[model samples]
Target: MTLKKGIVYALLIASVVACSEKNGTEHPDTATPVATVIESEKLKFTIDTLTDKLDNPWGMAFLPDGRILVTEKKGEIRIIKDGKLLDEKIENVPAVYDHGQGGLLDIALHPDYTTNGWIYLSYAKPGEGGGGTTIARTKLNGNAFIEFKELFSAQPFVDSEVHFGSRIVFDGKGHIFFSSGERGTKENAQNLGNHLGKVLRLNEDGTVPTDNPFVNKAGAKPEIWSYGHRNPQGLVYNITTGELWDVEHGPKGGDELNKVEAGKNYGWPVITYGINYDGTPITDITKKDGMEQPVWYWVPSIATCGMAQVISDIYPNWKNNFLVGALAQTHISRVEVDNGKYVKHERLLEKVGRVRMVKQGPDGYIYIATQSPGMIVKIVPAN
Candidate 1:
């Protein structure tokens, strides 16, 4: 579907009505939408099938017992045990709106999970006219997630379902960071007061981090660590560098891999390499003076999702690189860096449909979430 500017204008009109219903002030438009195409060599991957298939599984996290937990888009979570899919799904998940891109989003374990027994989740909590992305915590009991409670929710929720931006990861220091999507509102990306389109910092239990970038600012979301993003679904705090990294979706092109920094704006709606899906220009410049440019970006989007830092001590071939999952591109992208600069990007698993999430397993191999009639595949270097 080629998204024309007129269509984008119409979408914005509807968005304004949705926001007005909730009594938010209307702001001027920020940037135009754009569309671009990325074409690269066809790639290949090895798929180690899990025991069970899932329905649009959006997130994956391994429990200490080596059981795999995957969250489905339709609000269900399944447990995979011993390379086999368990037929019974854990119940009592909170109700989700599931409109466009919103549903059960991401899952992560607490750093002290063995002692705390906490499993964190991000989802779209259904509400009156629409919903907003929410970060919550719960405990796992057998196959079920129990004692679930909302730790934080985007306020003045809009009417659209796209761009839920629900990725969660805990830093080494026990602080949590949650990604908030720009809910079909381009102008909101520049609004410091709004919760949408920002990387937020909070304590493990969901209290605002006093050291957050905007904690003392008036009208700014108190938890905002960095601002100006579209839909940031990939977030990981690199253990080696102690830095947070995120990859986000743009309109039709302009996928980005960013080193998420404290207080800096990431330059979304205001500046993008993407245009409206209809092929119009988005921003005048790819780099602005004050706004931070991406550490690396795709002129033609890779439809990037989850990513993880690859660490290898014995194999030593793929160390210190980033492995990113691609939805539109249908591959696991390996990004290599040298001397704090992006060196190269290679694709793995070109025909595997959607590689939703990527993570390094405890046993020293990569695991991926194949969303669809979902398949969880373990990636081992062909030896």
Candidate 2:
């Protein structure tokens, strides 16, 4: 009996050796497995390029049929279908200002898109004298935008083309929220009289909601939801909590993430952690009694551009987390929030190019839009 047991043990040791040696041998039929490097100790995913020919694509939305609509900064909307960029640009898009930081920007679909076919866009539009951020609603009908109407535009358009804080999002409660930058003028952020540097909430057809905080205030723009923002390019609505969140660019440092609430002052130039671009001090304070503070602020800024929340069943680890697109640092920031408070964050997809937008598709895959050699990449489980 002892001899039999010894033979069994010897065979078990030999089997282990054979498995370990397999790594050193070349198996021609077995393809080399792709390796994944962990980042920030929180995110583990693989980026697969869906298309790389986009020209500085700024934003993208997935169609129900699995195609994608991408907006190029040069005032064109390109479609990606069947893993190939379509030859023709979508027709009847608004004429974009297309200068400086202004141009074709964010895009979103209605929550009932499967039934209503409503598509919303935010862009820099040519106004009477200069240009400003504008929101337009249109219907997508066979490669063209039909029945398009300008839904909202920032008041007193500025001639300068920079700092168009244009991002569009919808809360489930029958309202739309959009942001507008101060157009390189910091004082406009503090003034309640102008729509610049403020987030505006509107009904689907451009009318200001009566419930807006500034609606009853004399001399204030009734559409104003929250004010005192810088160049905010990222806005998203958290469906689970029914709250809106946004990220904005800072001067030299102090990029910020704020939980947007109605009728609140975000304290831009008056209270900031950033210095001017010329290395001058913008403010001596970072806090005050009447102003709202950011949930998180990044010193030595990353120049964050776009944001999206991950609520995918496929990525259980990343569920309910927010993904921020870092343009200057060329990475995606995974931020975790606990009970509406910022808990922790980590950077992901470092050096993949300037991440212009990060979105979660309806099919549970995270999509990233990169600038420079513009491309759309999808993130999935490394498997």
Candidate 3:
């Protein structure tokens, strides 16, 4: 019996040697790091182009049918299916300013989108002399927006072609949070009466929430959630924690990623870590009393745009990383977060051109939108 057991042990040792030396290159059995370099001989990627069905697709929300609803800056929404851009655009899109960086911007579906049928849009509305970012809600009826009306507007904006903080997201409390750009007027961000450069919490019906900090004030606007931001292009709510996070573009530097909270003030122009385009100083102090500092900042500026939390069920290994779209760098930034702190930046797909937005699609894929006859691209894990 002992001799039979020895024979079995010898066979087990021989199997281990075969796995390590014979077939190891093709199927590695030992433990590998999470970011382990793929062996080129054992791996291959199928680069299937999906742009034939895309037209400068801006922001995309994957529909239940596996097709995508994409926005074109020229004020059109097109449908894409099976790696092809549809020529037929959904009609009844609202009129937009379409000047400079303005046009129909972000689109977000209601949290209970399947039942409510409500979709939100952010656009630059043509004002008397200038424009303001207009937030509106509409129901999609047979591929067109219907029953549409303005829910809110960023106020006191000038005629400048810059600074429209049109980013919006749904908070966990069934309320909407949107940002208003500084509009080249720095001081307007600190004012509570007007909405410029402010993160606002609003009811679904467009009225201000009663629990807002300024609701009891004599002349203050009740929708104001947090004040003093620049052109905040990125905003999202963490699904796991329900906490709101945003990233904003600063002057030459001082690009910021902040945790937006109620009633707090984020000092933008008055206490920035950035400088003017011509190297002039914008602010000296990076932090001051009674003013909130950014949770993370880019000293040289990444020209940050849209931000998305990498949920685990979708991208298993990239769970905590907030994918930041970079316009200036023309790359997607994988911002890894560790216990509410910024850890590292992993540049992904640098050759794809200027990334406009990063979003986790409902189809369990990472959707990245690019500008200039914009196109939407999907990121899938290599098998």
Clashes of each: 8, 0, 7
lDDT of 2 by residue, 12-75 (tens): 1121001012334532211122334343464455545556567889878888998889999889
Candidate 3 C-alpha lDDT tens digits along 1-383: 01111111011112111111223244232211122222222222122234522434457676777777877766888777776666677778889877877778878888888888888888888888688889999988777788998998787656878877787788757799888788888888888888888888898778888898888987777888889899899999876697889999988998898888888899978889899999988777788898888878887888989888888464566776788988887766777778778777766655455677788877667777776325565665566
Supply the global lDDT for candidate 2.
0.82
Candidate of highest lDDT: 2
Q: Which regions of candidate 3 deviate over 4 angstroms? A: 1-49, 52-57
Candidates in order have lDDT scores of: 0.77, 0.82, 0.73
What is the Cα-based lDDT of residue 268 in candidate 2?
A: 92
lDDT of 3: 0.73
Q: Which ten residues in a row have the lowest lDDT in candidate 1?
A: 11-20
Kindly provide the TM-score of model 2 when superposed on the true structure, using C-alpha atoms: 0.89
Candidates, ranked, TM-score: 2, 1, 3
Worst 10 residues of 3 by lDDT: 1-10
Displacement of the residue 290 alpha carbon in candidate 3, Å: 1.3
Cα deviation at 164, candidate 2, in Å, is 0.9
lDDT of 3 at 333: 73
Whichever of 1 and 3 has more lDDT, that candidate is 1
